[model samples]
Target: MEIRDAVPSDWPQIWPFLRDIVRAGETYTWARDETEESARAIWMAEALPNRTLVAVDGDTVLGTAKMGPNHRGPAAHIANASFMVAPQHSGKGVGRALGEYVLDQARADGFRAMQFNAVVETNTQAVKLWQSLGFEIVATLPEGFNHATKGYVGLHIMFRPL
Candidate 1:
């Protein structure tokens, strides 16, 4: 699969899965009915230090990732990122590949470290993947996430020095 910077033309291909995932309310913190314009404003943001990337196999878009400063100003040295993989492409190593790419890009872009703000406690696959990639769960906020199925769940703050 080829990993590359996402261009405007790619959003049409990205929207379907992006809409589905956000609507599901299982993994992300976005509003369930988040609008297309808002998604573009965040996902395809045209601002400094923000970037979006796609993982593709030929003409198909398997997944995407967005990365940038975890916060503004002096706190900007710490990087943050989020990922989404098409449900149909979940087990194809798409997430692992994307995670590795984001970490490298964060370091290349001069981030001192990478931090994940809120990783749902029940998302074991993601928690495991991040751990395997050298991140540690630095803290867990009890009942921080209001999960759709499991009710309240912990939200893990993961981190790793670049």
Candidate 2:
């Protein structure tokens, strides 16, 4: 798989997978009822400057990620990121490639560390991937995410020093 910067024209293909993932309400913290326009705006905004990427295999997008300053001004040196892989492409290493790419990009951009703000504890696959990449569970917010099937699940605050 190849990793590359995402352009606005890529949104049409990305929307479906993004929508499915959000609607699943299992990993990401986005509102499940988020409209297409809002999602488009968020994704596009991230693509500007320091915030987004897509993993592609030939012409097909296998996954996508967004990275940015974890906070503004005083906290700007720390980076934060999110990742999503098309369900059809899970287990194919798309997530891992995207994760590694974003981390590299963040470090190259001069970030001092990386943090993931709301990783759902039940999303073990993602938790494992991040942990294997050197992140640690810095904290867990009790009943942080309301899982569709599991009721309330803890949300993990993961961190790794760059």
Candidate 3:
């Protein structure tokens, strides 16, 4: 498998999973009925100050990630990121590979740290993976997320120094 910068053309493959993930309302904060155009606009690759990557085995997209500053100007040293693995490809280490790549790239780009501002607490796999990667949950907003199945749950703000 290989990971590289995503091209607009790649969205044709990415949309299926991206739509499914967001609509499921299991992780990301995107609206459950988010339109394709709106989601694409947010996920599309940018020229600089941010980037998006896709993981593929040959021509099949396995997952994707986007990374950039957690905040602008004075707080730009802290990078922020989000990832989405194809549902069929989950548990195959796709997320780990993406996470590692983001960390390495952020450090190389001079980011002082990484922060995930709203990680859903009920997403235990993500919580565990970030922890194993040296991230700490610095804060948890009580009943911060409205999980579809779990009703309400905490949102964890995870951090790790680059």
- Which candidate number has the best lDDT? 3
Candidate 1, run of 10 with poorest lDDT: 40-49
Rank all candidate structures by their lDDT, best first, as comma-separated numbers: 3, 1, 2
- What are the clash counts of all predictions, listed in order? 0, 0, 0
- In order, what lDDT does every prediction score? 0.93, 0.90, 0.95
Report the C-alpha lDDT of model 1 over 40-156, residue by residue, as the tens digit: 888985765889999999989999999999999989999999999999999999999999999999999999999999899899999999999999999999999888888999999
Predicted candidate 3 versus true structure: per-residue lDDT over 40-144, tens digit per residue: 989976776799999999999999999989899999999999999999999999999999999999999999999999999999999999999999999999999
Q: Global CA lDDT of candidate 3, please?
A: 0.95
lDDT per residue for candidate 2 within 15-86, as digits (tens), equals 999999999988878999989999987875453346778899888988898888889899999999988888
What's the residue-level lDDT of 138 in candidate 2?
Answer: 95
What's the candidate order when arranged by decreasing TM-score?
3, 1, 2
Candidate 2 — which pairs collide? none
RMSD of 1: 0.9
* Candidate 2 root-mean-square deviation in Å: 1.1
Model 1 / residue 137 / CA error / Å: 0.6
The parts of candidate 2 lying over 4 Å away from their true place are 46-49
